[model samples]
Target chain A: MDIIVSKDLKKKFKLKHGQRVNNNGVISNEIVVLDGFDLKIKKGEFLVLVGPSGSGKSVFLDIVGGLSTPTSGVVYLDDKIVEAPSAKTGYVFQQYALFPWRTALSNIEFGLESRGVPPEERVKTARELLALFGLSDFEDRFPYQLSGGMQQRVAIARALATKPEVLLMDEPFAALDAQTREILQNELIRIWEGTDTTVIFVTHSIDEAVFLADRVAVVTARPGKIKDIIEIDLPRPRDGDIRSRCEFATNRHKVWDALKAEVNKAQQDWKLAPAFAS
Target chain B: MRLLTVLPKSRVAQREKIISLALGGSVILLFLIGWEILFQSKIVNPLFISAPSRVVLAGITIIKDGTLLHHLGISAREFALGYGAAVVVGFPIGIILGWFKLARATFGPFIAAMQATPRIALMPLFIIWFGLGMTSKIIIVLLSAIFPLIVNLQVAMGTIDADLVQVARSYGATRWQIFRTIALPTSVPFLITGLRLAAGRGLLGVIVAEVFGGAEGIGYMIQYAGSTFQTDKVFAGVLVVAVTGITLDVVLDRLGRHFGKWRSEAAVH
Candidate 1:
């Protein structure tokens, strides 16, 4: 049985402002953000959703993580229909989103505290988690005191501290520099390999998707739909050599081909008027 | 020995030390000279604009009379009670209105209207309602202080960093936990700022209330002294008010600085 499943998921937002000049006037039309998107994840599998900007990848991740409600269809986590964020599913946001007011250890312990973990045990567990991430010395330091890469590492540690069955990452390393991104990507693979948690990672970077995922799901442009699912068949702990391999190039090309036309079409439909025209 | 050697070794440190000492000494000297000149010149009626010497004499006289302590105590008590009440009431209401959409929609406009109206104008009404007693003075102070506290808190809550809130929610924090752990800690600086602002307003409220109608307080003493042409006593009362305001402001400022260390740490990255 799939650990996570989204069936016929649909979400639409009303575009109306909160104003009514006439009683009988139509408010506004609805804008569809996600339309009949379907996906499923096997237990402990690393799945990546790859798409262009505004293709609703984050929205889809939010739906799966129960951070958002779908207008239609249902999302089941371990056969339970998810209605709200739970301890069973950990979410890592694109911005890292570590609590600025909290130190590294405190941030990690936040999830444990919410689950009613005892203070001593929670502190011990958080310490262990930080040690695993090589952040033991920085436990007392606040998020703002750390570099971006370090902050994201803390975010990951915080997410994993709850020991959730599934980890939902919404472009978690997208804001980092290329060097930091690569290092974190490798670190992520190492962490995921050591755990049995199912991972659903979203990103627009094909390289990142290809580097991390067992299967990459390509999403079509706005009013997003699943365009294709490409199995990576890449071996564990992939390093820089994989980027140079023929298989990597072939898979990258395949993803680009599946994505290029949709990306172009989206750009065309959503293009802004030129500010200065000759 | 290392610390002693390091003190003036660096150019930056030496420059800062010299500049700071020079500025401090010059300010003190300027104040002393200005006071001496004012007393010696006596350009205006010395009786009306009492010299620093005469003001000190008046202070000694009030001290002897035992009324100075009583008035200070009364004013201090009024300020504390009123300001405390305002903070206790305003903070929770602001949080409630900020947290709930329905509450905000219903009460937000009313709060805005209340804040916009000049609270001083309600002194007459307050005196009438509560009578010319400590109760009326406190009400006046509360009226002056509460609005700023509520307004600041509401704005702070509204503008809380979305990322922190999201982080708390993802941790499976309930609404209450989120407010306590995330919202409350994040809004500390704003709350302190509001309280500091309210302290000044609270003092003003107390003074205004006393001016309108009060038997014993700084403002009432000043009014009485002015009417009897005891200008030195009046100047002494004015000085007390100024000192109280200044002391409260300085104390709150130091407290803010002490607490603001965490905020600055958060802002650096």
Candidate 2:
């Protein structure tokens, strides 16, 4: 069953660039980020979106999570139109986005707090999530006290505290070292296996896409649309050794082949007329 | 074998504290001795800069007579009320200005102008309006202290981490929740700084107002003694004010360090 769906999703941003253009006072320029972008994420499916820098992978994820609205077209979360950010969807940013003032436990309790869960129940749920993330020892530590990998783990725990039906992540481990990234990727799969949560993860790394995703969706350059969807038939219970497998390399190659032209076009477009907002 | 034995960290810290205290005490003792020697040697006129001994005598006399305590009580009350009012009033105004663009646009320039204007310059007007009394002095203190608190808080509100707000929003938090959870906790360091600034300004305001025209307060005592050429009494009063200011500041600094412990912890990153 399709848990989350978007029909002809389009996002346009009106950004003011440089100075006046010929004194006509036409200070604003509109760039279409996503146009005719369509995708159907199945229930409990692990999907990874890969694209160039300026492509609307992040934007589409934002729209699906209700963090943003499409310029045109519709998005449905469980057949109901998504108009605003709802507790039903959880979003994890690349920068971790853990509240610096809040401890690991309190940060995890944030969504439960928003949902008006009672204090005892909130603490209980947060503690359980913290334990599940293997951060029970660091529950009282603030975000700054935790290492990068640990902070990301807390962020994931925070997002999952509400038991959201879908999880949307935008290059969540992009800032970590390669080894940490791979460890987190495996950790993420293990966690996903325990829940019936649908995840739509966006990343620039083809290796990440091939490793974690059931299907890799390659989005095109600006005015983004899905260029190709490559299926990763790698078996479940995949571990660190999965990255060394021949099937992983082949799937990674396929995603790269589909994404290479879009990346080149995006780089050239950036060089030619760089819109500032993206 | 004994040479290799090292002191524990706490023992080292204790020794450092004792050394610092002794050094600080000696400097004060030396300063007092130098002033007394200057007076005794007739290098400086006692009529102008009274010796520490005479100042202590004058301080004791006022204390025994209950005059110093009386004036101190009045001044302390004025300061407490005024500073308290400023915090109670200014903080919300600042948050409002920061949270609402419309409020800021309407009053921001006027607030800036008032802040730039020397608070002491408005003393005569306050005296004229409220009369030469405790009310006028308190008003002066409130006005002087409020600007720093308001301005700091307003700037703090603007400086909230956008990413944190985004995280809260993703959780479907209400605007109030965002402010309560994100903006308030993050603004704590700024608030402490504002309080410290406000304390100094408030003290200045009370002293200046009393000195201008008042029958009570430490400022009035100093003004009266100076006018009467009682240099020792004047010095005694001035000493009281200095001690009060320093004590208030130290208390605030300790409070800031306590509440803002996370700030220094974050800095380690």
Candidate 3:
């Protein structure tokens, strides 16, 4: 059964007249971020959405995670309409949004605390996840005390604390250095393959989408919807060495080919409004 | 020299601290000596500015007679009550104003107007209404201190990282839960800053109110001494006020450091 489904999802941001839209002075009464966006994810499937900068991939992910509501249409999770955030879906943001004041252990336990999980069980779960992420020793350390990679690990652990059925990640490794990003990507895959969670990850990098996804969904430019869904015919238990394989190159090329026009269209939109091009 | 050379690495830190203390003390010592010499040689009129020796003598006399302690107790009580009231009152209001746009829009102009009005000038009105007692003085301090706390906490709440709140929301945290966990903890550093500003301003408020009308407090003592041309007594009172302000500030600074250890550590990272 499909764990997540969005039926004709549309989101439009209304702006007041003469309101500062972007750095560019392009004024519009409404900016449509998503229009008739639809996707269906099978249970435990690894789906990655690749798109250009302003293609509303993150916006759609937000809608799926229940962090946002679409202007029109409905999102169904487990055949139930999703209207608000719950323990059903876990969200990993682009920024490591770990609370600065909380230590690694407490941060991982945040979702559990919200769910009113008993303190002893919460501690056990957090420690187990911490150990899983190689962060057991740093559980007492605050976010600022941890490296960016470690912080991201804690953020993921925090999101997974409630053991949600679906994990929605929005460019979770975009801020990391290249080496850290690659290492984390491998670690993410390793950790995720062990779970039965349906993953919908969004990114701009075709390499990332091809590597992490079972199926890569390429989204169109503004008023974004699914352009193409490319199947990654790679084997399971994928690791860092997958990137060196010819199959990896072929799938990467296919995803990029599907995305190239949208990327150009998005860039043209930016060029027309030069302020946002930056 | 040999003992110093043989000192351990940990003792070197102790040595550095001692050296710094000595360096700081030397400047005050030189200033005191210069002041004493200037007065003794009659370069400056002793009546205009009393020497450190005379100020000490006057301080000793006041202490022996118990007046200094009495005034200090009264002033301390006023400061404590007023500052405490400001925090109790302003903090929640500030959070509300920051959290809700409607509340901020409604109260923002009034807060701005109150803050802009010179609160010192209202002392006479307070005295007339509440009389020449601790009530008037306490109100003055509260008036001066509350605004900064309100303004700062509001700013802290207003400028909270939207991403953090979103993360909390995505975890199924309720609005109140988000406020309790994310909003309040994030505002700690700002609250401390606001408290510090309030402390300085509250001290000024209390002193000025006492100077204008009170029968007790260091401000009153200083005013009475000045009226009688007792320069030594006036200097001693001024010294006490200055020391109290410094001591309050230092205590608040230590509190800030304790609560905001996470923030300071962020800068290190």
Candidate 4:
């Protein structure tokens, strides 16, 4: 049932910092963010990847979404290597990423337009998706005219419009307020149930990972690798009250425990980082 | 007892408009009255500074003789040829330079240098090559006007977010498709800016060309009347030029607004 398999993935970013004197060039630090990273995502499952800040969770997610290329190693979707971004896999970024110039409905129809869907048909499909997301009346409004939460909903609809087999969301609601974030979590769960697509969601929030994912994958600090993947055995069609349930608190605690060590190490490194420079 | 009555909001808005229009009209009327006072008293010498009434008489005489139309037509034609050609050529070149770094590297410095150099100084060279005909006047107009359009459109192209382009590419959109959907719509405000700047600069250029050495134009008429101490005729020519400049600015502002309504609406944020 596995739909995505990434093996021994690695990424390195070279940072050239400080001043340059006499045209001799400045110093650079090559940070290897991910190495020996391995993961398998099952078909039709909501897999949430949680990691400490700067753990390359988003970077790895981009690689899997075909938005970027790894320094080495391969990520496969149904036995095919993901080489370039295509309509097969859709991505939603942290910043909503809705086109400001486009109206709510037209933003959803963007992917359809790229795929050559006729105007009349794409409008119909976009309109239905807007209604499904409870934004039907705001279809004529631009992204700038919408609230942050409403814009994110449009972003999600835009990602789903092409009917991709895989959806990659990288902290899509990270910019939202706390109350809106909670509401969006429920909407995400609702939307997931309504579709049969495989979702690989990345987040830094423990409560979000536990509340939304079927299984949560915790990653180590820099040079990221999966620390643990915990399966949630909670009852589905779970209502908002489920967050107050004993099992919900337990699962959230479990993810927090796994992530705490890496976070502390990252903070300690951040403090000592200046002294350790080459 | 006089008291202000509270009108409905929309009607009050119209009343505000009327008051504004009245104030705008009074400004011009006051200036005209002051000039007439100064002229009738002969404070600055009547032969040098023409009275408003004499200038109006000169304007009417020129109109009836049909000489004013001929001069204005010549200047208008030169401006149209030069500025129209600049827009047709500068827009695409600016887009190409904006999109491709290599093209920008090659042409950017050259274009900047051309812009910085005073194009009016080239009029003597143009006169020698193309003669003091319509051709020379239009060439000067093109040189003066094209720079702002190119520079503005190029900068506008740069302001488009790279993330938006990446998103479009992620959805399998082609280069042409992406340009049509994203770059073109986004560059509209910049295009309007370029047009506005070019209109002002092109007006200066066409007049300068005519003043320096052109057989017939509003600028030529002014220079001819000034040398002969025909102050009324000179004032008439100046009035025509001022009116033409105001008309151009107003027309361009409306055009810019027509293209920019959606962008401005979104830009409220």
Winner of 2 and 4 under lDDT: 2
What local distance difference test score does each model get?
0.82, 0.88, 0.88, 0.86
Residue pairs whose backbone atoms clash in candidate 1: none
Which candidate number would show the highest TM-score if scored against the true structure?
2
Once superposed on the true structure, which residue ranges of model 2 sit more than 4 Å away at CA? A17-28, A272-274, B1-29, B266-269
Each candidate structure's TM-score, on Cα atoms with residue i matched to residue i, is 0.89, 0.93, 0.92, 0.91
What tens digits encode model 2's per-residue C-alpha lDDT throughout B164-183? 88888888888999999998
Please list all clashing residue pairs in model 4, or write none if there are none: none
Every candidate's DockQ is: 0.36, 0.44, 0.44, 0.36
Model 4 bad stretches (over 4 Å): A17-28, A271-278, B1-26, B264-269
lDDT of 1 by residue, B68-111 (tens): 99988898888889999999999988877877889999999998
Model 1 chain B is weakest, by summed lDDT over 10 consecutive residues, at: B1-10
The alpha-carbon lDDT assigned to residue B148 of candidate 2 equals 88
Worst 10-residue lDDT window, candidate 3 chain A: A269-278
When 1 and 4 are scored with DockQ, the better candidate is: 4
Per-residue C-alpha lDDT of model 3 across residues B76-176, encoded as one tens digit per residue = 99999999999999999888899999999999999999999999999889999999999999999899999999999999997788899899899889998
Q: Which regions in candidate 1 have their CA more than 4 angstroms from the true location?
A: A16-28, A272-278, B1-32, B265-269
lDDT of prediction 3: 0.88
> What TM-score does chain A reach in every model?
0.91, 0.94, 0.94, 0.92
Candidate 4 local distance difference test against the native: 0.86
Is 2 or 3 the stronger prediction by TM-score? 2
User: Please, what are the lDDT tens digits per residue for candidate 2 over residues A125-244?
Assistant: 999988887888888877766889999999998899899899999999999999999999989999898888999999988999999999999999877998999889999978889899
User: Interface root mean square deviation for model 2, in Å?
Assistant: 6.4
